[model samples]
Target: MDDERLRPTQLPLNDLATAYVQAGQTLFLAILDDIAARVRLAHPEAAYLEIGIDADGDVELHGIWSAQESAIGTCRLLYDPHDDPEQEWRDGPLDLDELVDDLGRVLTGSFLHHWGVVEPHPVYEHRDRRWLVLPPADRAATVAAIVRGHVPDAESLICRFAERGERIAVGFEQVTLSGGGTISVPCPLCSPETEDGPWPRDVSHELARILGQLYALPHLRGRHLTPCVDITAEHEGQLWQLVFPYRDHKKGAESS
Candidate 1:
């Protein structure tokens, strides 16, 4: 077999295809901005909002109230399609005012639960309106909350790492709207084998997968540029630390 023939082919995009992709990206950003604006209007006291969009277009919104350090109100919007076949295949009419009102109610309930006025429900249960009241001083619980707030199936991911006798701690060192920033993941098992060794393939792969989900986050997609994450992992009982920089390849040029 010829050497060139064995290699994979790269397909070139025409002008129309390029335009189509650009249009889709622009519309996606617009929708995210609209949702964010609504959330802000509803909960002016929210310190920061974390939004997660799934493959099915369902949206998960979490508003973290800074005043109540341990309070988080969660709301999920299921993608409802128009029932009429003759109509264009699109989402049904969504009442923004009603949605915000419901979110307010959930936040109120969360506050009541925090103050011991209402009984708290199980954290693992799935509900349309849920409140997570975390312990302010617990680092591991806070890490788990951050992971669960953004990633789908976060519990499973955490359990998987635990099963391997590894604990993962993620910190956002710096994040910008231009998709440029650093995420620090400190874990002994994810560290490189040697000082001058190459980046750990397993760790990089897992981080890349998680970043793909995070890329859809409204706060990070400002310039549509691929973001880079700097991971620093230290081995257990070791004094030295290794820094591995991983670039997300979802879009834009790779960073060195």
Candidate 2:
């Protein structure tokens, strides 16, 4: 082998690795910015964050949605479409509160979100554990509101029973939009940027999936493929500004 031909290929770790990470971050945010343009237009001060790929090739994404909020929140809405549990409830009242608790646990277990490149099969229920039926339609909004009030604000993730649909999808949802559809407000698949990917587009992929779940809830159906995006920004100490663009936000790139 020629003397130069045998030179070792550099690995990502220190400076180069950090630089690679920064570059990846830049790429991911650019894609999200392009995607976000479909949502709220643009902000000169805002930038969506991109947590770069992990050493394991795993990627987590985060995005900031508004000028006031620096964090992009991810929310999921869940409702058992199968009325089995509800039907059982029709028989009589049985530990419904306990059932809600159990159901919450079941949904949290769905937290793994994305398994990446592999088949997206999230374990919905564990041994002896299944979803608990929600209260009657009249009380669902109340329950959802209470749940939201109790959850940590930093999570930017909300789960509620607002829609009349049978799909549980996670999305980079807009808090402001009144109507729906490709032309009205840009959703994940609705955007032109939607395409095949292993690129930072993976971030977009994950974000859209989660947003889909949040948008369609209360009447959640039987099937789901969890989509997650991870993005983190390190500050002083181990603290970091994290955004899960799964809300479909791109905090604008840091201006040079």
Candidate 3:
């Protein structure tokens, strides 16, 4: 019955809402910028990319595409990380190649899985339909190349391998670096019989070059988390394994 009782209280709800919206916008923009930078680096010709998060926490992309010199391009993309056969394509079409560069590699997947905060139990193997295995020594060098952004000794050799459509093979030798450290490099021609043998000087150098490209990616380079991987590679129907920085990296981060 009283006039004061009938009126609404003047709470600062509008200010509170504004603050939350601004904070959310900042976070969304940061994530988009990160993803976009990585995409552009991988596809230098990428154009008009737009990534954003909606109010409901849905991440989205727009105006992105890739060009192929001799191949027809797809107009749309399927953004599902798990590669679900039943998943529908995203409303927006991005360059599939660029998107894969940003999210498909093991190092990039690990980065997004750990930092994107979008899912529990991130699925890295979804992209691992094919991978390589290398000895621990090669893994350690590859990891170093990733962080350093250049293959130590095989720059020319990697280019040669690239020109010839050859790739480094991974091996399964049971070796571990002191402190669990590992490295990576691009690879040379692979041999199933010699999977466990040490890489030739040329092969090691080329592998380093391949890893150098991965390390140079903005998402992987700028991330605060140190990545350690079990390296695997795919090349011309050959399957091999390599090493990455996992246990040793975490231990170092924790100790630091």
Candidate 3 residue lDDT tens string, 1-256:
8766633534566556655544443343344455556555544444333333346544344334433235464423212343564543442344555554443332232323222222321126433222111112232345545433432222111111111112222222222344444433323244534444334555544544444333323353334223333234353332222333344557768999
Best by lDDT: 3
Error of 1 at 187 (Å): 15
Q: Go through the candidates in order and give the clash count of each.
A: 0, 34, 38
Which tens-of-lDDT digit does each residue in 73-132 have in candidate 2? 532321222337545542232333443333233233222122121122123442222212
Best by TM-score: 1
What is each predicted model's overall lDDT from 0 to 1?
Answer: 0.34, 0.29, 0.36
All candidates: TM-score = 0.25, 0.19, 0.22
Q: Where is model 2 more than 4 Å wrong at Cα?
A: 1-13, 39-148, 152-236, 240-256
Off by over 4 Å in 1: 1-23, 47-68, 71-122, 127-256
Prediction 1 TM-score vs. true:
0.25
Count of backbone collisions in candidate 3: 38
